[model samples]
Target: MGRGPETAQLSKYFYEGNDISDLPVNLSVVWNGNFIIDNPQNIQAHLYKCSALRESCGLCLKADPRFECGWCVSEKRCSLRQHCPSHESSWMHTSSGNSRCADPKIIKVG
Candidate 1:
């Protein structure tokens, strides 16, 4: 990442776990000159695994071989209930949570 005020801020809170919510919202200055925000619906499929799993382990309350229900129904909740590896807090549960990969602009689709 380019070394600048935005990069510094992103690194400070993102890696250091500093008070991110307290930081200014519009203070970001994109150095890469690219709008890094991603649309939620456009996100990958496996990303929703948590919500899917949490909703229904997909086995009708039984250990169905077809469903093959594992921990936390699926990967999404498994990450959510257990913290997501892709982003901070698996879903930004904390005030200081800030994962550039998991932007809130995403729209959950059915």
Candidate 2:
């Protein structure tokens, strides 16, 4: 990730748990690198985003069955939950009090 004065500032802001409501109107552009100030939420989200290939199964601690072993037998399989082994402990409640796996962007759909 790119690091510099701007990155440091964004990191500090996010670490403080400041509300994003105070962010400027051009939050999308700013976060997209169209401007100097990077949106802290976007940066942190990307940093912690889970990778199916790298993450393992939280329950089994083995290769992620959804992507590798394909042995998940639950009616509501892990894939449906977008499970990320790295965030398993907090899968039910993330920093925002919501499961990141539930995010539409992360969930796989047929």
Badly placed stretches (over 4 Å) of model 1 are 1-8, 11-29, 32-49, 52-54, 59-70, 73-81, 84-110
Clashes of 1: 6
Name the regions of candidate 2 deviating beyond 4 angstroms: 1-33, 39-43, 46-77, 82-110
Tens-digit lDDT track of model 2 for 11-96: 33222222221232233435335556656675422211122332333322233232232212232133323453444343332222
List the pairs of residues colliding in candidate 1: 40-106, 40-107, 49-76, 50-76, 50-77, 84-90
lDDT of 1 by residue, 1-110 (tens): 76755553334322233222112222323446776665445432111222332333222123222332233322433233344344422343222223223223434577
Error in Å for residue 95 of model 2: 17
